[model samples]
Target: MKEGTVLIIGRPNVGKSTFLNNLIGQKVAITSPKPQTTRFPIRAVYKDQRGNIIFVDTPGVFGKAEDLLSRQINKKTLESIQEDIDLVLYMVDHTRRRDFEEAKVLGIVRKIEKPKILVINKIDKTTPSYLAQYKFLEKEFDRVHMISALKGKHIKPLIDDIFKFLPEKKGESEVDFHEKPTPILNIDSKTYVAELIREKLFLLTRDEVPYTVNVEVEEITPRSENLTYVKAKIITTADRYKKMLIGKGGKMIKEIGRLARKELELMSNKKFYLDLEVITDPHWQERIE
Candidate 1:
């Protein structure tokens, strides 16, 4: 049996996360139709007669990281490319015009020593000629696959061809498709906290504010019924920003807490309390070493 890991990577809004869901046939990651919806890497095990592919959904490669969380995400995404990845699924949204980052993506691809397959996604919005015209990209990569992950068109051939190119690790030969165990990769605890707080900010803020707000989980306490107390710092660059987050009469913060806590309960399957506070720092996130 062929067995290894595949990393899905590309620019933001390229439908990388959506393609991951289609490949794994599960919704292991959330989709918001927004950029940067995926904060942490999510793993979904794909097992079939041909092989088992552990697909890792990574945050889309974008702007240079200015803060701790953004820096960490970019660092991790690049680091995954350096890992023992079986293949790299570089996806581009075919419906939209390519951006400057497409040049950046080419640079990154040049640096990746591993074998890669370019996938042109969002074909549901294009004509055959639109996809057929990417001869330049076809000449650039060893191989390319085209499909709409949303509609599941031409996915089986892509998956079949993907396994055909994998370099199998030792002990994989002993594995059986029916008997091979599926890997249930869970989110890292520390990263989970950061994502929770970031998601809370994404839910609460508007305009450019959500992008500016960076959260850090400072503490956690365990309690009965599997409850865990969480305290996070909502860091902003100015006192005015902090005041905006806290909202009028503190109502905004309260609402954020209420909404986040309810989602937390649904996620943890336990009751827990939340204490949300705001802080202003010239550059708390600049503390990144």
Candidate 2:
């Protein structure tokens, strides 16, 4: 039996979040079409008859850090990968060639001195020639695999390879192998609630509205045995955005809240009374955590 941690790092919009969700067979991380959707390292567990593998999904690496927030996100990505990891999965969009960002990311991976796998994601969008272009990378990596994360193609072989490189464990488990996989991190209810709201915010709004907004869960209280009341404040960069989010007759805010409430109910298995408010806070992202 083998057991260890795998750290996944990649450039922005490389499908890191989608890959993690597909690998784990659950939605442990929130994903969107936009870049920078993931801001922190998300931890999940994958177990089988052989052993258990702890997976950490980190924020996407970008070439330029234009703001303090981007710099902080980059720091978090590096900090997670530098830990005592058993393996590193460096994913790249198969449709795109190696560029400056990929070069920079590889430099950091080299310094880690751990066994690494080069994953070419989104192969469904590319042709055989595109895949062949990266074939030379096989010699540079411990192992390389091309996969379509969104479509779940060629994943079983990848899983086999992932477990093969992990360090072996001593004991055998008596528990049933059919049992469901569990999460490794102690996930906070408020944190995920906030994240779900932010995800919906990204999907509902366009352009800078999503990027310039942040969700703050002000209160979560249990009002009854199977009922909870949640109050969240959506912070926007300007009064114009705040009003835009509110929309005429409060249409936009209502839609966002409605979708978020439905998801929260399914996740918590409880009835929820959700109250949403939008406020202008241009420096919300700049505030020290």
Candidate 3:
């Protein structure tokens, strides 16, 4: 079967998952307004009567001097498009300035030797004054098309544009709606870890705690029939933050576990034993090498 992969690379909180959900007409990835909500490269395989396009939604890249995990995320995001990226979709905020930080990410995208599409999201927030300066915005992104992703604007044309760039489908693979073949309707490993942590942080932590937290799966094993155990570490840079995660009488950790376990059981379709631990390991911290 003929296949092609589309890499969605952009900064944090730019609506990558939302954009993808709109494209596939399904909720495969968890969408939250929080930055770094998407931590993994989620693959949504869409097979239509025309062809199949594998969309890889990646973690948002933010250039930070403090969090090591964020640095790793940005590194991994760049690595996604560095290899076999058939198309690179770079999402930019139509309402924001091209600061040095955002420019850094764009620099990485500029290096990708593939067809690049600039998806300018959040145009619904724009005014007539903003529209008057649209041309000025266009100059910042060379050969980029502007569209409001949240309002479902220009998405069809955008998909059409993506299909145009994709290599033709050989028509060998038939659509298996019963089995739901071609389009992958599940979140990947990176996404699962990210969502578990994000949902917890969003609920438990306030202020900077939610922003600084990162979750990684240390181990996953199947113990017996219809049973699986997930060992994951919730990482933070500070010991005080660690205390916060544990909370008063370990209430915080328990809540996080309960929520994650419930979601896992629903996804796994089996009994799940989720063991969650908090770590202050600087390995995935905010600092750069």
Candidate 4:
């Protein structure tokens, strides 16, 4: 059976996370319209009749990393690429024009010596397309796929093509699926829960609010067999941003907590008491190591 590691690389909002989630049939990473929504590399495993594959969904590389967070995210993406990867999937969003950001990501992808695949994502969007600009890339790679990750179009064929490049493993599986309860390997329950809350913050908030905030889960305890108690804090850089996150009469915070709680409950098959609050810490970005 063919088994190996695959790394997905692309610029911000190019649907890298969406593609990984769809391929695995699970939400191992959080995604949003905001650039750099994925702050770190998320490692998850995918298994089928062919073999086991480990997929690393990395943070999108930025053309100009003006902020401390953006710089850190770019560094993380670079670090991920340096690891032992069996294959590389360079994805691009066709709905958006190819520019400096795309060039920056491509410059990095070109340096990888492993087998590479050029995946053109968002094929469903035809009106505002720069598909012609990316067509020239087809000659550079042996395989090119046009897929709509969100719609799951042409994904099966892409998976089949990926296996063709993978090296065969003749022995037992490397990952002990019986011991690992979830496909996600790099994060614990607390970190995953924090990410879920952060996703809500990203989806509900507007403009810079989502970018300026970080979610931290202070404590997660079982109150009873049917319920879990989770206490988390939304850390931001300024009091004004905190006030906006809290909203007038606590409307915004309440809604964010409600949506996060519902998803947590659905995932765990138990009730959750999410004690969420907003706080201001001017140096929160500095602590992002």
Number of the top-ranking candidate, with lDDT as the measure: 4
Give per-residue CA lDDT, model 3, range 1-289, as digits (tens): 3457788888887788888877777556767667776655777877666677888889888867355566677767767776676787888775766666677778887778887777777777764223333345455443466676667787777777787777755555433456764356455564565466567667667777875677777667789989887888788778898999889998898888887777777766888787888878554554433
Give model 2 RMSD, 1 decimal.
Answer: 3.2
With a 3 Å backbone cut-off (N, CA, C), the pairs that clash in candidate 3 are 45-183, 66-286, 67-285, 67-286, 68-285, 68-286, 69-284
Give me the runs in candidate 4 sitting further than 4 Å from their true place.
Answer: 170-172
Best of the two (1, 3) by TM-score = 1
Which candidate number has the best TM-score? 4
lDDT of each: 0.72, 0.83, 0.71, 0.92
TM-score of structure candidate 1: 0.75
TM-scores for all predictions: 0.75, 0.89, 0.73, 0.97
Worst 10-residue lDDT window for candidate 4 reads 176-185
lDDT (C-alpha) at residue 72 in model 2: 75
lDDT of 1 by residue, 1-289 (tens): 6788888888777888777767666545655556666766787777877667878888877665565767766776787787678787888887665656666766787688777888988878754344544546886676799888889887987888789778664663433545633434555554566666666667677776665566777777886657788887788888878888999999878887887778777866888677677888777656643
For model 4, residues 1-289, the per-residue Cα lDDT tens digits are 7888999999999999999888888889999888889999999998899987889999999999999999999999999999989999999999999999999999999999989999999998897989899998999886999999999999998999889888998587677788876585698888999999999999999988898999999999999999899999999999999999999999999999999999988877999999998999999999989
For residue 89, what is the lDDT in candidate 2? 92
Q: In candidate 3, where is summed lDDT lowest over 10 consecutive residues?
A: 128-137
Better of 1 and 4 by TM-score: 4
Evaluate model 2: give its TM-score: 0.89
Residue range 1-289, candidate 2, lDDT tens digits: 7888899999888899899889777678888888888888998877878788888899898778787777878888988976778999988886777778878887887777888899988878855336665676778789998899999999888889999889887476322345643655436778778888888888888887887788888899999999999999999889999988999999999999999999888877889998999999889878835
